[model samples]
Target: MPESWNYLMDMDGVLVHEEHPIPGASEFVAELTGNDIKFLVLTNNSIYTPRDLRARLARTGLDMPETAIWTSALATAKFLDSQRPNGSAFVIGEAGLTTALHEIGYVLTDRDPDYVVLGETRTYSFTAITKAIRLVEEGAKFIATNPDATGPSREGSLPATGAVAALIARATGREPYFVGKPNPLMMRSALRALGTHSANTLMIGDRMDTDIRAGLEAGLQTILVLSGISADSTAEMYPFRPTRVINSIADLVGNSAAPF
Candidate 1:
């Protein structure tokens, strides 16, 4: 049976939790694959490319194809590609981000750029921050993968790419043009890839603030899996709630029944 959803799911909490597989996530994803459901791992973490994400998932026992995943790194690259013919970008991010952007033919230059892209900077140096801000204030377009305040790791969570982006935004008196979840651009690109719109789609995520909000804003039904960031207790504070909430993806019995 064709599900009401042509799905787009988040990878971090919904599938793998900080370098490990969340129990039952594989079952949930298997259900979709068994049913011939079209889905993509739409994640805002630019720390890893699609291939890297797949590799990580494979280590944790879920072997998803690279084509079935999409990362903010790739989206940011594609976004800049459209914005500038031969755009030069100033990237204050990790190696994964710069690598993805470069693959798409962006000139990653610090001296002159048409855009300033920000992500989780492993080396969040004062020099790097200052240079990014100067470039933005000097008329370069400011873009960020997502506005996450912290990065999720097995050690817990740390100040995220959004924190880095915030400093530059503060310095320039301009907000970043966000490209990841909670922003419509990510969903727009996912829809284009799926060749379907919201009505036939469902979004599965872990964070209500970012993942759920992004799907809701993009007009897709939302599912929250509590294996990652947004725990059940934390969900109560949200202004809006997910369409369904499940303990794990494996708890899902069938397409007709819901766990909420």
Candidate 2:
């Protein structure tokens, strides 16, 4: 609740709703930028790079710089690079995941890779899943960008990386190491990127299951905003609770004088 706390915020719910900018979201971002507060917009979606996400947010009237964005793809890539530098992977994902791995000098191949990496994709291919299963069965490590079972879409919720990872796990009897939200590793990576300590960092998220859990696990203060997936009533069901709850990010807009 301190005024000097750095922020780590979720993208979809805390900043914008779907493709639209949440009310007062831009002002909140502007306040942070103007004050030179270190912050990062976090997302479990591994489909787009930070640059792509920045442009998308720009269209929603929020001018978030690429440096302020962090996706699961980047976190996963960093994890892999640290765990096994220049390792090979059989990737089942899109440009974001692939590009991150490539940037870290990972070889994307099906020829006995060190890991079979799974990430969110618009169209998950059965052929690819079959190949992934085979690779895992043959002793390749399994890794997933996130544990989200479903992803938001215009039509409705679509099966996400976790669901697909479940399928592959069932087939090969190997569980995937999920590297995104709900995992403290992602928060640690984001914190390192922000160059901030957890004690003075605030994590604003909408979901108790992933964002809040991750923040708490990473030793950061968490705030649950009601503008996203979870409601106040739902908070009681969770054994763990966020440090604070707010109606929306709009409430925090120029009111940094008050403890958030």
Candidate 3:
């Protein structure tokens, strides 16, 4: 409800569901841009770049610029760059993760690299997982983009980065450092990207576990919308709570000029 509050919003449930634009979502985004409100669409899905996501969102009737989008891939790449500039990694992911690392000047190699970067992929290969485990055993630091065990798909749930990371961890006895949501590092990274202070930023998400927890840990106000995974009753089970609960982002649209 702060007048100066900037926003970091989740993408899937807040704006769209199953690649379909949610009702009032387009209006909400327009209101933000029309007022020149600073906000970023944050997501843990690391399979696509900002450009790719922007195009996809457009197809769903939500037009957003690439600069207003942030992904786990970008966060992971930034984290790695900070840890070791020009580092090499054995990456297991698609263009999103690979392109991020490449743009950051990281070499993708399998020959005893500095890290084993794991990320979301539609088709996770057993061969790649094997190589990742072997690399971890060879002393390469293990890092995963996010801790999401299951990803939504038309065919039901599919194994995500966290699930694969668990398999690698069990094999090599090395726990991966998750670089995405639920880790305050990702939130802080997004804040840095938006040039916003945590105290003056609002983290809006539907999931209480990842989004709300990440925002709380990063010292930002949190909003849990019922349009996604979390419900009103679900918040009671968590020790921490969102600062506000809304039916959807549409609620924020009409009040864009006013304090949330």
Candidate 4:
């Protein structure tokens, strides 16, 4: 491992699973902070703000500061601010997405909005979806926080932003620009946030299709962990491969010298 190496880690699978911290995840995070290593916990879930996520993680036994976390909502807001500063949007999501846009000086409105932004939510409102479709048809650009079609829940899989975005696309004949995982834009934004170059940064994730793919495209080395969505056999199905495939974050605990 490089002495100056930094890290970009996926939150759901790499550190926690279904609101519970994975084994050794806390130790691994502590080691990084203790060594003054720069790193960020990235997540495609746009339902919660970093502050909210920090509290959630703390309950799960992973003590992390809000500054150490990044979300697709934040990335989306940053992208929008760069594209059109102080823009307006018709948002369909929770406080996480709304708060991010608000913080970026984006107005949340429905009349002649600049964009129709979609994000993850527990309840998918038909009224909101209908309004989003109509707005897109009215020439408002479409944007989604992530491309994930489904999200995990205690009961089962729930329709996510991608699934809702697909419906809007089918109605308006326009595809949304996704700003989260699998899009190098988000990865680059994260790198910029950390003030680190991709060459000396490592991305740790569980999914090959999104996490690994995004990191690889963003010029960062990638590690695939089997503690989340992807199984050991899952990588073989992908066209590309992660630099390292480990059983879990537990394996990386107390072993900085191990080949990443």
Question: How many backbone clashes does every candidate have?
Answer: 2, 0, 0, 0
lDDT of 4 by residue, 195-251 (tens): 999988989999999999999999999999999999988999988999999999989
What is the Cα-based lDDT of residue 203 in candidate 4?
A: 93
lDDT of 2 at 149: 99
Candidate 3, residue 77: lDDT: 97
Candidate 1: where are CA atoms >4 Å away? Answer: 1-4, 154-156, 253-260
On residues 1-260, what C-alpha lDDT tens digit does candidate 1 reach at each position?
23356778888777777677887777767777787777888888888777777888888989778989888887777788777766788888886689878887888898878888888655678888899888888888899988888875567768888887777777889899988878878887888877888877788888898888988998888888887778888789998989888876666636522333
Q: Residue 212 of model 3: what lDDT?
A: 97
Candidate 2 deviant stretches above 4 angstroms: 1-3
- Candidate 3 C-alpha error for residue 49, in Å: 0.6
Candidate 1, position 29, lDDT: 71
- Measured with C-alpha atoms, the lDDT of residue 77 in candidate 4 is 99
**List of clashing residue pairs for candidate 4:** none
TM, every model? 0.90, 0.98, 0.98, 0.98
- Candidate 4: lDDT over CA atoms? 0.93
Instruction: List the candidate 4 regions with Cα displacement exceeding 4 Å.
Output: none
Instruction: Give per-residue CA lDDT, model 2, range 1-260, as digits (tens).
Output: 46587899999998999799889899999998898888999999999999999999999999978999999999999999999999999999999999999999999999999999999998999999999999999999999999999998899999999999999999888899999999999999999999998988989999999999999999998999999999999899999999889999988877643435
Residue 212 alpha-carbon offset, candidate 2, angstroms = 0.6
Residue pairs in collision within model 2: none
